[model samples]
Target: RAPEEPLHLVLPSDRRLLRIAHAVLEHPDDVRTLEEWADWAGLSPRTVTRLFRYETGSSFAQWRQQARLARALERLASGEAVASVADALGYASVSAFVAMFRRSFGLSPGRYFDTQAVIA
Candidate 1:
């Protein structure tokens, strides 16, 4: 994913899904379950699940993970410390954040930014 990508770039047209998407984007660190989110949005859990897949072409969990990653990339690019970024993103530890970063981008955060610098 591009580091410059905006969080609200493509929102679901459905108001209920839009509400949840906005909430997730605004609070990527929020670890709420789908049922809880659905209740908050005044939606049925099953409806939210199906609508997320239909509208976003991904599951709610996947969408939230991507949002978190986007936020991570933005924060890291702004020169935030790795540990600080991990904590802000609600990772259990810096290592866990690094692991997820590796899985997503095939490089550690430091290396990833170093590479972007070179590419730029």
Candidate 2:
């Protein structure tokens, strides 16, 4: 995906999967494990994992990461501080958030914003 493009989350047809997706999208900072989420959704962990991959074309972990990244992009575009965004996203540290951002977009948060500014 392009650095400027928004991440698209697929909503599954299954009610259980849909519930989990909505929760993750609504609260990307939630750091619950797949098993915990499954329990909350009244699904077995194996079912959750299998259905997430089958219905969404991504694992639960990947979906949550994308959700978090999407929110991070929105906040950063609105001129939020890196540290603030990192904290709000439940990252262990600014550097950890930066690393994830860099891995995803191949640029640090500051450089990403700078590039975005230039493009705009």
Candidate 3:
């Protein structure tokens, strides 16, 4: 979680970042593009990146990665398989998802889920 007061909080532009987050959380079936969000937020991509970094204390891509991981974890915990979660999370393929999962947790998804994989 971020601090109470960050160096800068740029999400106040129409609350568009929050809206985009809500949209993703509300309907995972529809993944919104960065361009779409830029339009919705009424800011250029460069400004969006800057504001997103300011508010989240991370680059937009990094934030999106964590968000996608979080969503993947939720779906996985809900009994959804890895392939499905990969598809839903906008991954190019299951292998990509597995790589990311392993990178984040130091264990593959299946082992992580079953508690059989050791953390390196």
Candidate 4:
């Protein structure tokens, strides 16, 4: 039989923060507060806040927003409509989503992909 593929590995230094990252990836659409994430991680809110920064070099809110942006990028790349991707990613409106996309990527979604096409 073929050998099994290796499982994803996390270094000891990163394991503590993996839980938070997994939670964010699993439910990017949910607008839970940091306190909720803290409670779910079985940590005090302040500890979660501090450790998240230490491990990820970003505040929990920023990390979560990045995760949401990553999800939006995937959907947009797959040719999903911008309005549908915006709503599914939990933006209040398409304009809000476009604003965030521009802020994060320095280009609107259409232009972002257009640039990628040129680079490719």
* lDDT of each residue in 9-102, candidate 1, tens digit only: 3567799999899988888878889999999999999999999888887888878888888899889999999999999888889999999888
lDDT of 4 by residue, 25-52 (tens): 8777777788887777777889877887
Ranking by lDDT: 2, 1, 4, 3
Enumerate residue pairs that collide in model 4. none
Query: What's the residue-level lDDT of 2 in candidate 1?
Result: 59
lDDT for each candidate structure:
0.86, 0.89, 0.70, 0.76
Q: After superposition, how far is residue 52 of candidate 2 from its true place, in Å?
A: 0.6
Q: For residues 5-116, what per-residue lDDT tens digits would candidate 3 score against the true structure?
A: 1123233344767776566656554556778777876778887787777777777666666767777777887899899999988788899889988887777888777763
Q: Candidate 2 — what's its lDDT?
A: 0.89
Candidate 4 to truth, TM? 0.81
The RMSD (Cα, Å) of candidate 2 is 1.9
Report the Cα lDDT for candidate 4: 0.76
Q: Which of the predicted structures, 1 or 4, would earn the higher lDDT when compared with the native?
A: 1
Taking every candidate in turn, the Cα RMSD to the unseen true structure, in Å, is 3.2, 1.9, 6.0, 8.2
In candidate 2, the residue pairs with backbone N, CA or C atoms under 3 Å apart (3 or more residues apart, or in different chains) clash, namely none
Best by lDDT: 2
In TM-score terms, which candidate is top?
2
Ranking by TM-score: 2, 1, 4, 3
